[model samples]
Target chain A: MKDVILGIDIGGTNTKFGFLDRDGISLVQGELSTNEGETVHDFLRVLYQEVMTKFKKIEDEANLIGVGVGAPNGNYYTGTIENAPNLKWHGSVPLVDLLKQYFKMPVFLTNDANAAAIGEMVYGGAKNMNNFVVITLGTGLGSGIVVNGQLVYGHDGNAGEIGHTLVNVNGRGRMCGCGRKGCLETYVSATGIKRTVYKLLADSTDYSELRSVSFNDLTAEMITQAAKRGDKIAIDAFEYTGKVLGMKLADTVAHLSPEAIFLFGGLVRAEEFLFDPVRYHMEKNLLHIFKGKVKILPSGLGLNNTAVMGAAALAWNEMERGATA
Target chain B: MKDVILGIDIGGTNTKFGFLDRDGISLVQGELSTNEGETVHDFLRVLYQEVMTKFKKIEDEANLIGVGVGAPNGNYYTGTIENAPNLKWHGSVPLVDLLKQYFKMPVFLTNDANAAAIGEMVYGGAKNMNNFVVITLGTGLGSGIVVNGQLVYGHDGNAGEIGHTLVNVNGRGRMCGCGRKGCLETYVSATGIKRTVYKLLADSTDYSELRSVSFNDLTAEMITQAAKRGDKIAIDAFEYTGKVLGMKLADTVAHLSPEAIFLFGGLVRAEEFLFDPVRYHMEKNLLHIFKGKVKILPSGLGLNNTAVMGAAALAWNEMERGATA
Candidate 1:
């Protein structure tokens, strides 16, 4: 039988799983609701069954060799997800141990952002790069830093929490779910721009379509559409968001000195609306030696099953490392 | 023959060179003036001759295996010193190639901070650590970031320039030697604190011994002595310095998430004056998950030939990697 690995992305709303061959073919794929209020055990049990049912069709052609997982707070060292806010489960979830018992295969796990970073290295723009960063912009901002071709897991399993880092040390009253003020996520994420929209409406008399929308009704998509239509408020919001992100990226450059930074997820769909500002401000803020040297590029994975691809890459990397060792 | 590495530290004023056996002994040592006004050729010729003379005694006991160099703006990828303002040399100098002709052995070079980082990992507190940062608090704040047991060289071999990162986005006129305003070095270095003393004197009327001293005459030592004598301005200077350093370190933690940070050079000698504030503020500013996790420690090597030890470690690490590969 051909060797294949199982890739799982444990998202809050839905869980996606697929079997990826060594050549990167998705032999089989399946999905199941996470069931927000249900026990993690119940969810995993259902997910396992669903995934296996799909895997059965290709059983004769492919052998599932190992499992790779990506979750909100997945820890590679402990193989647990701890305090992931969006997930249904409270406290730490030992999903890896539970899955290993059912699958009887080698298992590995890491945070969602780190999974994306490994994905970039294994199957994306950073294939030959030894140092780069992957910044994923979604409901919240997430970052994965790779130095010398190795993921920076830090002393703790939780190393890449750039989203929660403060942009305004003495910020005026903006708080995050992480209970911090002036977090980068508060200023740069999808949720952040909505908040910026409300703040702009309150402070300015400028007429804009966003002023008609309620805070709860407003979505990142609406803002993108408005910006595309040349609404002044929407345009300004994107510019401000990119400014904060570029400044933080400049800090990342100073600290890690990566060859490039990859921008992924929803906001990247804005294309030049976001990329132009990020490049201009980042280069403006970069140290003289690093000026015009680092590239800020689009994520090659796009929006299609990045989490699943990331998980698969993680598994492939670990399996390859094990064999080489 | 017993294998040993030669370590060299090229400073603007003085250059230190020493040989180390595999057992970590400083077998032989020598020094020479860099003589900035003269051509690099003349300086290297005299320096190589002086180093060779010192190596003569140990030549019988230990075989010269390799050479490691630490200098301002030293690039490991190209093994050159490029555009270091502190040195009288105005442009890039191919120091490694010039030295290689004299020694005819493998040579490696990296910036002073990176050398210090390797020294910490190979010979100091971080020997067991795979991720840590070394900040040398001397003439200007210099940093070396180590992730996954490897030094980050970035795209251009200039990854860890943390000193140049801006502390104040809209900071009031604090220009650095690097020609940037609000640079962390402008507020955290020895020269920075001296400048702070002058600023404090200009802003406050509190009578202190510093008012009696000229800018050229005033020193960090005198300030420390004054603080010991209950001088308010001197005490405030240390506090303000630590606050800036700690706040910046909090940002460092958010970005890299290293196990610990090692502080080296002159200002670290102040000990509690710097440590207490750094610890207090670093923990306060850190994200909830990393609040008490990261440690700020004094450099284990201190002033006892750390530069030599660091350069030696770089050479030894390279030699070992070459052997294993």
Candidate 2:
């Protein structure tokens, strides 16, 4: 029988599971509610039940090789979801161990952000790059740093917290969801654009459409649409957000010296509205050796399939390196 | 014959070469003026001639296995010293090829700071660690970032420039030797402390022993002596220096999540004056997950012999990696 691996992305809202051969082509796909209960057992049970139906039909056609999982706070070392704040699960959950009992196959797990980085490396533009960064710009900024072609999971499994790194170290700036002040995410994420827009409305006297909107009413999509129509406040918000992101990324460039930085998420859909200012400011602030040297590119993975692809790529990588390694 | 490897540390004023066993015991050592002429050819000739005398005597007892040279702006990938400003050589110098023509042994090269890092990994506190950073607090702050038990050379072999990373992004800050403003080194190195003192002298009315001195007349040693004697300005300078260094290092901890950050240089001789504030500010600024977890410790290597040990360790590492690797 032909061999295939299962990729599962356990997100806050939904869990997406898909089966793909070692070649990355999907053989089957589906999703289940991740918040169905506090534990992941319910979701995995339903996912497996659905997959088993397909597996029995394909028994003579394909073989299940292993399973790969991606989740917030997922630890590659422990294969546990360690108190991921977004998930219904409150504390460290042994989701991988639970999956293994159901799937009865070799299991591998890593943080969702790191899985995305591996996806970029395996099936994206970074296939040839050994050093690069993958940044997810969703509600908050999530980052995965790759060095020498391996994800940098530091002393703790929580090595890729670039969002929380300080940007404005001066007086009390924006407060972050992480309970920190002046975090990079406080100024650069989807929520960050709203924060910037709020600040811009308060600080500037320019006539703008954003001034009419309340904090709860303002959305990143609305701001992008406004900027596309040449709204000064909306455009300024992206520029300011890009300025902060580019400057902080310049610092990251100094620290890790990655060959490129990959942008993934809805913010990337803004195209030049976000990319232009980020490139401008990152280059403008970088050291001479790094100035104009690093590339900022969109992720090669499709936006909808990114998380699942990341998990699949992780399995493919483990297969190549031997699961134990 | 007893096996030996030659370790060379080329400084702006002095070039030191020493022969050592795989175990790192120095067998023969000597130094010569590096600026014998405008070119490295003359310097290498004098260096080789002095070393030949020792080699001939040890010919019956030792066999030379390899050579490792550490120089400013040294590129490990190319084995070339690219535009090292401190050296008499004006542009890129193929020192490895030149050394090979003379010594006839496999040669390895990296920046002086990276060499120090390898030294720490081989003979110092980071022997077993796969991730750590070695920061050299010298004429200018130099850093070598070790991730996954190897130095991060980036794409251009210039990855560790933590010194040059922006610490002060405010209005036109202190100008750095590299022509950048507000570089961490401008405020944290031997010269950096002096710069801080100069600023403190200009900005503050607080009286101290430092007021009696001019910029050229002052030295880092004097500041340490004053701080040791409980002089307020000197003590404040070290505190401020450590505060800045520690805060920036917190950002680094966020990036690489190194297990321990090893401090090396003359400033470290101040002991608690520097280390105390660095630890304090680093912890104060670190994210909660990383807070109180990362260790900031003094390097285990001797100050005078660190460069030598580092180069020796590089050769030993190369030998173990099968030279060709």
Candidate 3:
């Protein structure tokens, strides 16, 4: 009989699930639209039914070991999802209790970014690293810090909010969704890049591509395309974004001194265009003592499957901890 | 015979030596001028001569287990002092090699900030904490980060350079002694606060008792006194410094998520004048998850003797590690 673990990645729009073995090979992958407007109980019922039906053929052959879940605002210590802004859930939801009724197995839950970090540690580029940071550059910047071979959850499971760190105190007036001003997320995220484009357009008289595109319609893909075609304005925007990220990274390095910072998500797909500038500026800003160290690498796991793998890795980590004890 | 550990705190101006038992008691304490301008051999000769003469009466009665030295830029990984800017030293000075000639015992060395953190962990406020940050707001804003009960030393032994972290990107053009602009040390340290007062005098019409003091004569002590006397400008200076510190601390909290941050140095002696504003602004700037959970505590160690005690504790930590290994 084969033993399998259930990995669940919960998002605001959709939820992804996978059945995996010890080697991280997925036997079955599935997704379902997350009707966050519905009650938590109703959403769970539908999810459970779908999962049970999908695994019915292999239920007898495969022994289920545990379940791991990655969700927004998930607290590893309390096993609850706190007031997640994107979800309909208003307060702390006891996810462990709800999952226990369905799985009758050991379950683990952590914030999505942290799960991604664990994934990187177990199955990705950070396999040999003792200290590193995983940065997800999406609509907002999300970070997961790994210190001394373990994720830093702090006393209240609120560690690794590096995106909210102030990069510029008075450079921009764009308010972060977190109610903070001039945060790193305000200048480096996908939304932040668009704002940068608008600012650059306003500051420079360059015209070629993206001049006609409204600020609301500007996307990261368009910017990448423009840069590939050698648009100086687009190139400048990327350079500006990377410069801000690098300077902020220098400050982070001064504090924690991680071995590397792993870039993930859509913005990272630009690769050399974004990474070269980030690395160049970071090295320039770094202190003499910390020079020529700390690599900035891209996430090894594919974007579609990384979250699910990370979620599964969380369960595996807990299972190993239980065995060690 | 009672067992004692010799603790040595090496400063640019003076060197303090003390003998401590496991119970955190100081048996004998002495001080000597560090004449760093002299050759390394001469400096050690004087240090050893003083130690032998001072403790000769009870030398045979007490068994010395080890020696610990703390200096401006001491490295734990390699028992050497690397080009401390405050001292007249030029290159890497192997302090352990010189000390070993005098005493055939175990010796450990670390920078002053790391030594203080170990002191707090072993004998002071952070005795029970597995994670914490000790900030020394002296000539510079030195920081020591403890994660999961161990000090975080990066690729090089220069991990905790929190002073170099930029706090104000555009607030002022004051260049840091580190050759950087707007570093946290440029606004929070004793030197930093003086710079702030000077800037305030030049920019603002706010008048106080501080106006009469020249830039060379202006000190953090004077600012504290003026704040105590309800001087608005002095109070505003503290407020401004705290605001920058608190905002940066929020980012720090997000990175490591320590249980508390221990503040030390002459500036911290202002107590409520500094701490209240720091606390207020730290809370205001912190993410909701960490708003009231973490603490900002004043150092419990006496300023007069903390340096020696901290250096001793560093030796104690090394001894404990050796014993376990």
**i-RMS, every candidate?**
1.1, 1.0, 1.5
Compose the digit string of candidate 2's lDDT tens values, residues B1-325: 7888889999988888788887678888888888875567888888889888877777888889889889999999899999988987978889889989987779999999999999898888999898999999989999999888878888878899999888766425789887878889999999999989988888899989999999998888899999999988899999999999998998899888899999998898889999999999998888887887899989988777779889988888878868652
Pairs with steric clashes in candidate 1: none
Off by over 4 Å in 1: A171-173, A323-325, B170-173, B323-325
CA lDDT, candidate 1, residue B18: 93
Candidate 1 vs candidate 2, DockQ winner: 1
Interface RMSD of 1: 1.1
Ten-residue stretch with the least lDDT total in model 3 chain A: A165-174
The lowest-lDDT stretch of 10 consecutive residues in candidate 2 chain A is A35-44
Q: DockQ for all models, in order?
A: 0.78, 0.77, 0.61
Candidate 3 residue pairs in clash (backbone atoms < 3 Å): none
Worst 10 residues of 2 chain B by lDDT: B164-173
lDDT of 3 at A201: 91
lDDT of candidate 2 over A1-325, digit per residue (tens): 7788788898888888788786678887878787674456776677778778767766787788888899988998888998889888778888777887887778999988899999999888799999999999988998989998888988777788889888867435788877868889999889999988888888999888888888998788889898998998888888888888888898899888889999998888788989999999888778887887899999988678789989988988888878752
> Could you give candidate 3's fraction of true interface contacts?
0.64
Expressed as tens digits, the lDDT of each residue in A37-80 for candidate 1 is 37987777788789879988999999888889999989887888
Give the TM-score of chain B in candidate 1: 0.95
Binned by DockQ into CAPRI classes (incorrect, acceptable, medium, high), candidate 2 is: medium
TM-score pick, better of 2 and 3 = 2
